[model samples]
Target: MQFFVWAAWLITIANYWFGTKQWDGADFGVIFSTMGISSLFMPTITGIIADKWINAEKLYAILHILYAATMFYLPQVDNPHTFFWVILVAMCFYMPTIALSNSISYTTLKNGNFDVVKNFPPIRVWGTVGFIAAMWITNLTGSKASANQFYIAGVSALFLGIYSFTLPACKPQNLISEKKTFAQKLGLESFKLFADYKMALFFIFSMFLGAALQLTNAYGDVFLDEFKLFPVFAESFVIKYSTIILSISQISETLFILAIPFFLKRFGIKWVIAIAMFAWVLRFGLFAFGDPSANLWMIITSCIVYGMAFDFFNISGSLFVETSTTPKIRSSAQGLFMMMTNGFGAVFGSLISGWMISKYFTTYYTNIGSLSKYVNSEADNAHLLNFLKNKGITVLQNGDLSRALDVKDWHNIWLAFTIYVLVIAIVFVVIFKHKHTRAEVEAINHL
Candidate 1:
């Protein structure tokens, strides 16, 4: 859990708007979207190798080692093109470990005579704790604005890589004697889920929601850091501690996870998910208007509500898939769920959002000394100015025209995303029909 958080916690801040290291949001989008692209096949492909050839633990260890290699080199990546490819290599190895970790946990627990369903949620909560710890570490160590967060993760991955060899072996289920079809041997049978009407709809919507998930991840810290452009809010705690502040959302997300069972019991999947859609509305809306200054509480509240917005749809959606699928396809269905959310959804969201941000919201600037109201972050000033220059924006110095300080139009950008999620909620309510009852809620226990 610590390693996972170390790997992810400060990515947006470290990659997006950090002083000298800042990359274009679109470039960051390309970097981040690689996880989705890799997810298209890596997990399934790796699963095949692990199931038929290598031990799962060994495969996981090697991936982490490779991932660490890429991460350690990230600080030296000065250009967006190189940044794109470097993180792509890292994500390819890192993304598969998500599924592998769950597999390891389940197999290890079961081997010890423990019930996975009952024990896993508690164990999973540690990931959230680790996320918060990582955020705190990044901020406290001043790595939130540096590339050291990647170093932290790289070192952790190295440690984890070596330690993984010590875990119980997870041998392949598809041995030579097992007469499996070529598709089954490749774990491609799950692709058949696309043929089912309900499942097809579910996965489609999962992709849409998955896009929403990437929005906050891509820009939440950038949003907070942007306040440094202003006077009063520049020294504000929220700006100074943007990464830590964003960690509130993850902390809140953890707490909301605990409420899933009760909400599932009472409201069932449909309402729980509807509530989640509504929460996304609130989440982005709050961020749209809230600032690091007076409306800071609204931003904090938005982070708090993120728990409901994220967990209800994602966690509950997993349960929906679980109860809906047969045991044979259950694992694959979950993978499909992840692919829709984290893969296709992430790719779609990142690319579109990145492009949109670059096209419409790219901050234009005049002289560096002009709109830089408070602190003198010349590198950030120069970066944004250079970014606008590349966009062919007309930025001059000293006049009515000189005051052309058109920074990121975050309001419209977020409003667009808010409308996107709102439309998704409305369409979902009308088309996706499920009659939820108390009996349906019983499936949570089986998980």
Candidate 2:
């Protein structure tokens, strides 16, 4: 339900903002930071509240209900600024539920006397399935670039929240009762790990790669959809089925996750992570050159590579943390990794990339008059007109353009991402060092 609710709007919303509402690219970029900002504190705060004062299941249900309500209100927002705040409120209610869901699962599983390590992963796999299903439904139903995506998600969230009541209760406990101080409750002691050179460096790179993660999610769907601007590709299957094509990444993610145990054992965590970084290099590089026509294979290959690009870094990095950190600070260390990657890293990626893309990659056409004046010859003008057509631009009855048409240079935007991840991969290979034993690899399974 969680995955379905998010997947319904997350990928395709780019098209809604850019294609439907005609909002600025920089503004669209800021919307993603809402997740990062909420990720920074809401999970911890909600975790504390759930641990000390409330039943985890009930809290999870209530948050989803609130998320659903907020999502329902989102389609009424006519402007990007108001849309940002409304989505921010939705994110605040939604982000923490990810952690809360896990907590509830573990508690329910334990109460059922099931082995969490053995059972939890299979259950989690269904979340990806849910995500893929939502994407397919959104695209097939013609809701990808419309407010109907939000309605689909809102309905799912509402159903999930109501259904959660039927699940086994996971009551609050005395788990953190001994940790009296607010700092202790929040696990601020994990901040001391930043003093260690290796741990600190690992986190710094995590943030860098985290930025890379957001780039694809933010732009990928819209990139394919933007091909519609070119008349040659406007009716192409790639534009029509872009979300389903993107869903291949999630499908690949599940399959690649199964291969991680082998990769970790064979290559060690550091090299596995390095491979993931390089995989990202390939992912972006392929996208940089891919098109909806003959270059379509590049797009498909890139989707396949995303599994290794994402799972190898995220899952392997978690194992590395589990092995390296002392048990006392281990849980907090995991939180710190997530914070650096999904929190600070997300904010860094979203805001900076937004500004950068708006400044460099996006082209604005004020009107037909400006377009003609900017072109060097009739031939070039004809070519530009053939490319842009009459899809997104607006004309005024007074003979002035009502809105500026913004077209993004997708090739260079992807090439820039490729270069960024490639540089990080090279720096990581040179600077970070770790030796893994067979026991260390095996220990991950036991944990």
The best candidate in terms of lDDT: 2
Give the distance in Å from residue 137's predicted Cα in candidate 2 to where it truly belongs. Answer: 0.8
Question: What is the lDDT for 249 in model 1?
Answer: 88
What's model 2's TM-score? 0.94
User: Which tens-of-lDDT digit does each residue in 295-390 have in candidate 1?
Assistant: 988899999989999999998898888878788878778888898899999999989988898888777555645555433576666655654443
What are the models' TM-scores?
Answer: 0.88, 0.94
lDDT of 1 at 216: 90
lDDT of 2 by residue, 1-447 (tens): 889999999999998998888788887779988989999999999998998798988999999999999999999999899999999999999999999999999999999999999999999999999999999999999999999999999999999999988889888886543545678679788999999999999999999999888888999999999887655676799999999999999999999999988887777889999999999999999999999999999999999999999999999888888877889899999999999899989989999899899999998877677655445666565655655444445456654555677878899999999999999999999999889866575785563
lDDT of each: 0.78, 0.89
lDDT of 2: 0.89
Q: In candidate 1, which residue pairs clash?
A: 51-172
- Indicate the TM-score of model 1: 0.88
The parts of candidate 2 lying over 4 Å away from their true place are 369-392, 395-400, 437-439, 445-447
Error of 1 at 91 (Å): 0.7
